[model samples]
Target: MQTIRLTDLIAAIEGTAGPMGDASRSRRPGADPDSAAEHPTASGAVAKESLTRTGDRAAKEGRAPSGQGESLPVPRIVTDSRQVQPGDVFWALRGERLDGHAFVGDAVQRGARVCVVDADRVTECKGPAAEAVLIQVDDTLTALQRLAGWYRCRLATSVIAVTGSVGKTTTREMIQAVLSAGRRVIRSPRNYNNQIGVPLSLLAIEPHHELAVLELAASHSGEIAALAELVRPHVGVVTGVAPDGDSSNPSISGDGRYVAFESSDRK
Candidate 1:
């Protein structure tokens, strides 16, 4: 249904909000803004239509509506071949146990509109799959993170990031329900609090949302920092610190507006 423009995504990943960025209300501009928009690049090329969705969104829904040429809406993103649908972007992730690269052909066969691959594995996408738009990145994981960050920066909605060893999810849910009681709110779905999961959550944000409450979970070093860099929350919340809780506190944008929580157990 809704899609972010390819040009805007390029500018965001590059850390430069370009002309298209100024046009779209969302950080990741949608194709509907300028269907005729064209961007010729070697690494990340845009076809007649320039739009993409987060993997979570695509998997949760069925095939998207189709349009003609430049008027075409951006496709949804899917990491699994089984979820691939017409006008979908398949992110080829390389995990320790399995490599997504192996399924590029399968994705294309299933009607994927685009595919993200590593710089070294471009050759893996061949035959009919080559017809789909190819987005090459130094690393798919990093690309996914940057794209999420790009989308996060474009939002005018207030962002509330919560992190802790325990009760992070519970705290987020409570905050979301209370805020949503009055405002149009969007919060992280389920326990999506990791590198890949977080990005998908961010990408799920739509234009009408007024508030965003994202829950952050960190088990290793730099995880919180990475989330902070991407979200740059206006309000940072830290629940009670448990033994397995995230020691790294959420960082704010330092725009002179922020909120924090202590033990919440006032004696």
Candidate 2:
């Protein structure tokens, strides 16, 4: 996987990066104040400085930086505010039950260096969030998926997507076990096969991973197809057709190679 910088992530998600309080401002040492005000920090110096400080702290604590860079590495990405550590990037995702926007201040208080939020909900990020860098996107979930897809393209890892209504987990485990013998393999953890889970799984892929076996699951139509676009698997597998009307077969007509496996109780 290639190193993802703050600029790279902003571009990937099509987000606008906001300043991290006054520190994000770039003021020349001897330049006129008015002239310095005219020039915003578009050179990524703020990003570099913020990440460098965070990276230094993480290093002192014996923790690795999340994403790699030339001078300053990007911080770890976290969705749950409780999981956030100093210098982590907190993505505020609005789920069906809980709204992550409500916890922006909490994440910031916990030492998140960056907060990614929906453009419309920027006002929800108050207090401590003002101290952190803000990345505003149209939709947080979509931006996350886009980021995952962008990151996936930079990896040399070969992906294998598995989809089915039944036996998907079993099949995924089987494939992972078989591939683990000689390859640095990673697979979807537990039942991480949904929209959010799939992207999280893809983001978990490291540069050293040779093969990734990801399970794709869907409770509605077109979900599998959407995920497949991000996964862009080198090999696609179907363990069985959906028992319900909604099909679990992913569209594999693109560059992905297809394979079908059938299972029946009568056999």
Candidate 3:
């Protein structure tokens, strides 16, 4: 099997550098740079892994880093407060060393347009800049997943899923190469072919993508179903499975695949 890796230039960023807001800049011509920096949200975001949006898959895999001339707008999905910049949006994810909710005041002072917070914390927070919009979510992680799923459904192009006992990655690569001839195909990074990887792929999908081909692997039962629930691939092809009940997608595809409870353990 060929080793699949993504180039740093194309890997999505989960956090950002803090830029001082105008208010802080006005405090002094050359105020303390550290003082100017503020956290991204009331709480830092979920984790860097949880900062991705639903349909913005990263491209440029396998390509060397190129110097981009202009600054790209910071996506609002960062999971850390320290990554917050004045103009960026912040998602307050509940996690270690930070609760996105705990940093709302800093985010507002630093210039966050909106803050996503746990609905449970809505009544518990207060700050001077009461103007910041607080969007309520039942569970940040689940909400993020649902948002990605919704965004995935908006595409009008072809969506393909590939599964196999052997050479799943190689087959996916071949399929990607063949489809890249004329279409703007968005293949999952490496083998982001499972439950978590599928959603990550969907988060990276762009508005202009012409195709999405996900490479799937299953070492345990029900794993495909977990991936299937999130990816909902219109087309899927499984490679092979072990007879010791170590692999199958019975519930995922029924037609051929087996689903099991231990499917989400891929690292």
All candidates: TM-score: 0.69, 0.70, 0.50
Model 2 lDDT per residue over 1-267, tens place: 244566667655642332111111111122122211121110111111122223434322223334233222355677788777887778777654566788888888998767777777765674447666666666666667667766776777888888865688999999999999998999998767766677778878888899899997654445556666667777878776633333333232222122222111000
- Cα lDDT tens digits, model 3, 58-77, are 21222211222222333434
Query: Residue 176, candidate 2: how far off, in angstroms?
Result: 0.9
Alpha-carbon lDDT of model 2: 0.60
Best lDDT goes to which candidate?
A: 2
TM-score leader = 2
CA lDDT of every candidate: 0.57, 0.60, 0.46
Tell me the number of clashing residue pairs for each predicted model.
Answer: 4, 1, 34
True lDDT of residue 192, candidate 1: 69
Query: How accurate locally is residue 106 in candidate 3, as Cα lDDT from 0 to 100?
Result: 73
lDDT of 1 at 132: 61
Q: Give the C-alpha lDDT of model 3.
A: 0.46
RMSD of each: 11.4, 14.3, 16.2
TM-score of 3: 0.50
Q: lDDT of candidate 1 vs native?
A: 0.57
